[model samples]
Target: MDKQIYDEMIENLYWAFPLLKTKLVKPFDKEEKEKENDLTGTHMTILFMVKEKGSICISEIGKHLGICKANLTPLVQKLIDKSYIERFVDDKDRRYTFIKLTSVGEDFLDNKRYKVQEFLKQKVSDLSEADLMTLSASVAGLREILMKIK
Candidate 1:
């Protein structure tokens, strides 16, 4: 990429990230709370990771989430306390603890996600078809880049 374009991208990110995190992004979190799906962003993310993997080792989860064991222990405990997740010992190795989402957790994630989708649909109802397509493409590209870096 040319220097001018690179500079503009960096400048846009500087301004856009905070706005999206605080204003655009936070509303979904807030709505999840209203639906009684209250969980910290980190916790929610961990739950989703476990949900995706079906069952995953505690250490592997910590690694994926970039949380050390000390901090991860409490977070996992919180999820347990909320009954959103459960831990089990691996049948082959009792020392290995695996984490998995409870059915309640899956339902909560799905319902909250639906609400967020509806909200987004309404918010973008004013945009023209082409603008919406552009926005969709941009978001997909951003997701791809984030996955690579993370």
Candidate 2:
């Protein structure tokens, strides 16, 4: 990539991040502020990843989260303690341990996802028809491009 293009991409990312936080993240957070969370952000992330990957090995989850096994241990343990996830030793290979969300965990995630989607839908419902079309196209393009990144 040319230096100028690289710089522009960097600038766009910096600008987009705050807008996303403000327009997407903060609203749901404020609505949920009354509810106290028992799990930390990392815990929620692990649950989301496990839900996404189905049954995943401990080491594989660490790799995707950019967290080493040593640091990830306690976080995984906390989820297990909460009964949100289960760890099972692979039958064929005793050395491998896998994680998967329990029924409770799946319900928890489903509720959270539904709430966020509904909230965002209501937030954007008032957008002008043309603006909504443009926004939808921009989000589709962004998702397509971002998916190319690993």
Candidate 3:
């Protein structure tokens, strides 16, 4: 890629990130209080991470989240206490421990995702048909381009 095109892409990405965060991410976190669990973003992130990996060892999760195991223990424990996740020793090794989301946890995440989708739908409901089409295509293109990175 030409340096000029690269620079423009970097700048566009920088601006795009905050726009998406404020429009999508922040609202989800804000609406979380509706459930009364009062879970923080970190808690939700860990839930999502476990969901993505199916099951993940505690130490690996800590490394991915850049949190120390000492501190991650309580967060994991909180999830366990809420029955949102379960911890078990790896049967073969008896050394590595892993956590996985429970059915309740999956339900909770699904509900939250539905709400966020509804919220975004409401926010865009008044857009002109042409603008909505444009936005949809833009997002599709953005995803296609970004997926090439890895």
Who wins the TM-score comparison? Answer: 2
TM-score per candidate, chains pooled: 0.83, 0.87, 0.85
lDDT by residue (tens digit), candidate 3, 1-150: 699999998999999999999987777666666657577788888999999999999999899889999999999999999899999999999889999999999998898789878988988899999999999999999999888975
Off by over 4 Å in 2: 1-4
State, as a TM-score between 0 and 1, how close model 1 is to the true structure.
0.83
Query: What tens-digit string does per-residue lDDT give for candidate 2 at 27-118?
Result: 77877766876666788889998998898999988888899999999999999988889999999999999999999889989998898889
lDDT of 1 by residue, 7-110 (tens): 99899899889978776678767766777765788887888888889999999988877889999999999998988899999999998999898998788779
Return the TM-score for candidate 2, rounded to 2 decimals.
0.87
Q: 83, model 2: CA deviation in Å? A: 1.9
Residue pairs in steric clash, candidate 3?
A: none
lDDT of each: 0.85, 0.89, 0.90
Instruction: For residue 97, give model 3's deviation from the true position in Å.
Output: 0.6
lDDT of 2 at 106: 92
lDDT of 1 at 121: 89
Question: After superposition on all CA atoms, how large is the RMSD of candidate 1?
Answer: 2.2
For model 2 the local lDDT of residue 23 reads 88
